[model samples]
Target: MGVMNELINRENVGMLAKILAEAAPGSHWPHVVAAASELDLLSLRARTDAVSRALLADLRLLPDPGYPTAARAFRSALTAAGFTGWILWPVSEAAVTLALEAGSGADPGKDFDDCLALLAELTPRLTGEFAVRRLLAADLERSLQAIQGWTVHPDEHVRRLASEGTRPYLPWAVRVPGIVLAPEATIPLLDALYRDPSDYVRRSAANHLNDVARHAPALVVATAQRWLSAPDSNTAPVVRHGLRTLIKNAHPGALALLGFVPASIAVNGPRLDRDSLALPGELAFDFEISNTGPADARLAVDYVVHYVKANGTRSAKVFKIGALTLAAGETRSVTKRHAFRQMTTRVHHAGVHALELQINGIRHGHTEFQVRV
Candidate 1:
């Protein structure tokens, strides 16, 4: 089973139940386990969602387990279970689910504050991103106000969530169309977090900025340039990671901002061990790079494999091989093997395909191969 499938298995469920039972002995957890166990684990989403719902229902069984208070009770349970400094624990989904459940049933006038408090408590453990998105959907102005407050929170995790939760393209969560439409709104939060003392917070800020760059490339490039102008240790990496998508796409503005100028180099003797391979086989290829420039050349060596689709269209996937500063008159030889093993995401198709070597976003050489299934 994959990592997600294994995360909430029998053993994990028992641990979670024990933790809950210990934290709030009066709150029945045995029934929670029973309900959650019936969920189908055929896929990660189905299992997580089903269990999240089951957990929320089981919490409702408690005698007047109040909002925000119950969320705090769960947080206490996590800490008692020795999960105090951990982020994204196995039981995180349960906390997030409970937050969403409470928020969904909240009375806008009386329960709003309590719901936000619950989300604040849950954000550090698993994530409040999904739960916050629901609030944003209901009231963008109010939800954003709450998120803005978290930007300066004493807890780095809460500050990180301020940026991460509002991301337009947060992976594994539903996309937020509003953010894409107005990527500008998230800028202030990211700016507040760009120089966060915590690497964890900084990484989230970078990723959040990268999501904005997807919709507003020029804006993000400008933002990165400004951030890099006063480069600190934290901001430098944040800028690099934030501009990663733009760099990968070979956006000229991003390339110029990063100073990954085109270099003078020559690719020689592109050779494949075999021109064809069957399913479950691997393809090995070799190539040589010679620096022809008079000065040292900083190079980002990467390869792209153009895979044939079922309809005869081709999709290219880029993989980074190495990054180095090659001295003048230097030559380096590289060998790489690509596996055609079956995966849940990719299906092998028998056809001729193309491979290209790219140096600092410049294609250096091209070759072809065939795959037979």
Candidate 2:
């Protein structure tokens, strides 16, 4: 597989140079091309920032060397279909950087506001999600006030950007400290967006809420509850996705909201197919559950694998085992085959491991097994 940094390489950088050159007839953008040579040692984000600096340098030469001039040039490029795809990553970055730099001038607020507008315009070409972070960090309330209007924006990408750009832990994006410090600040944006007609927008809204759930579980649950109370057809899925982290952690409120309420059920052996296994192998297991309660019960069945880390201390990771509904006195069996392969995200360590069952947010049986790496 190609590495991520390769996404912004020589060919694409030249494409960007050609685009910018076309956008501004008299201006040269050799600097944008020069940036590609410096990208070899940089990570994906670093490459983006480096190219952004080069782009900004080129943009500064546009008759007048400030944000208004650069903003117009960007708009002209958009009109000419000069900006699109991965190339826009650095273009958006340069726009945000210019906007922040301009914010230090006499009319700081206007620069910031204009940058937000530029981002909205650029989002459809490629997300301004990463670029918007600098503005949020610079002046959060001002940025958010502008972004709140985006929840109802005609463009779904812009609407998604409103929730996605302000996410507390948006992946591959910088952390906006103010958003983290004041988690409630962005909830209103999410409130308006969770039921968006566009699934793309709704998914971003759900992921945004999931980011918040990492640190503010109660707040996430409360917001999810409110959405559930006044749901559209897609609300349940949105809430389920938004509450995924909480669900994995087995948060009671989250579980109950999704109808995986606490129930009286009998769990049989999580019965391992083998008590010991070699590395790069598979561990098969099966379990049976019976609803012993007087009423029908819903179950969110999941498995927890307590993997032995490098330090020899086991960290528990939860894996989903699908959901089911059982009539009172009914029984069902579940089988799962878990692979013990080395992953880039997770390294296998040879030691004793344990598998446990979680049904309806409650831990059931534990079965210990040995792993030979």
Candidate 3:
């Protein structure tokens, strides 16, 4: 895949300028274009901020310039100019910057509320998730109160944003300290959305809860329990995804909630096909599990790879091997292959690595292997 920074490059930046020029006639499109032209070596976020600053300067020069004026221009761009996609990133950012600036005025509350609405509108074009962080940080209660109403919004995108935008650890988005301080703050939003009819919205709600689980596992388990109690057709998957982190850590509450309880069982070798492999190779293994108890046992089988880090320490990463049910005294065997390909997200070091099996939140069957660069 192409680097994410390339998404907001000079070409798309010029397109954004052209669209903004159409939306608001006589604006300095050239200035925005020039700003992007000079951005040769900026990261994705830095490029977005630089372009936003350039757009904000132009927005300020509009007739009777202010947040309202900028909002109107953006609306016109969406409706009249038909602008959309990655190009809208800087547009949304500029609008938010203007809105936050407007928050220092006579009615900061109204400005905050208005900005939230603008974000809802802009979300359908391009996510306002990153932009809304500033507003949430600026006024947590007010912004959340406004977002609470969005759970019932007719549009799925807006409903998704209601949960996605408020996530405590939303990737590629700024941190909202208030969210971390009050972990339970966004629970109400997730509660309203976890059973949403739209998979799109429910997915966001699931991810939001997962983010919460990062800091407060109990809170997530509790929330998930409540969701399971009054579940709809899609609630099970939502809860599973939401509790994924907790499940990986083998949290008892999370495992039990998904019916992956402790059971009398026996595990055999995660027997390796080979003990050593080179880069771009695969490690194949198999394991057998027998339900030793009289009762049937449901299992959530997963594997952990203890990778050799650059500093010679090992870091464990979990990978899932689908779930299954074992009848009374039943035994099942499974085989899996894991690739050791170099990825941008992970570096391969020449050292001893290990693999282990996890079943129903329990670890079993350890095996070590050597990797060569």
Q: Candidate 2, clashing residue pairs?
A: none
lDDT of 2 by residue, 1-373 (tens): 1488787887888877887677777878878889978888887788888998998887776678888877877888886564687778888888787777774656767877998999999999889999899999998988999999999999999999999999999888889989988999999999999989999999999999999998889999999999989988999999989998888899999998899988999999799999999989999999899999999999999999999999999999999888899999999999999999998889999999999998877888888999999
lDDT of 2 at 20: 66
Clashes of 3: 0
State the displacement of the C-alpha of residue 198, model 1, in Å, after optimal TM-score superposition: 2.3
Assess the local accuracy of residue 132 in candidate 2 as a C-alpha lDDT between 0 and 100. Answer: 94
Native RMSD of candidate 1 (Å): 3.9
Clash pairs detected, candidate 3: none
Worst 10 residues of 1 by lDDT: 82-91
For model 2, give the 10-residue run with minimal summed lDDT: 99-108
* Superposition error at 129 for model 2 (Å): 0.6
Which candidate order results from sorting by TM-score in descending order?
Answer: 2, 3, 1
Question: What's the residue-level lDDT of 275 in candidate 3?
Answer: 96
lDDT of 1 by residue, 277-365 (tens): 89999888889998999998877777888998999888988787867788999999999988887787898788998888877888756
- How well does candidate 1 score on lDDT at residue 23? 81
Question: What value does the lDDT take at residue 246 in candidate 2?
Answer: 88
Clash count list over all predictions: 0, 0, 0
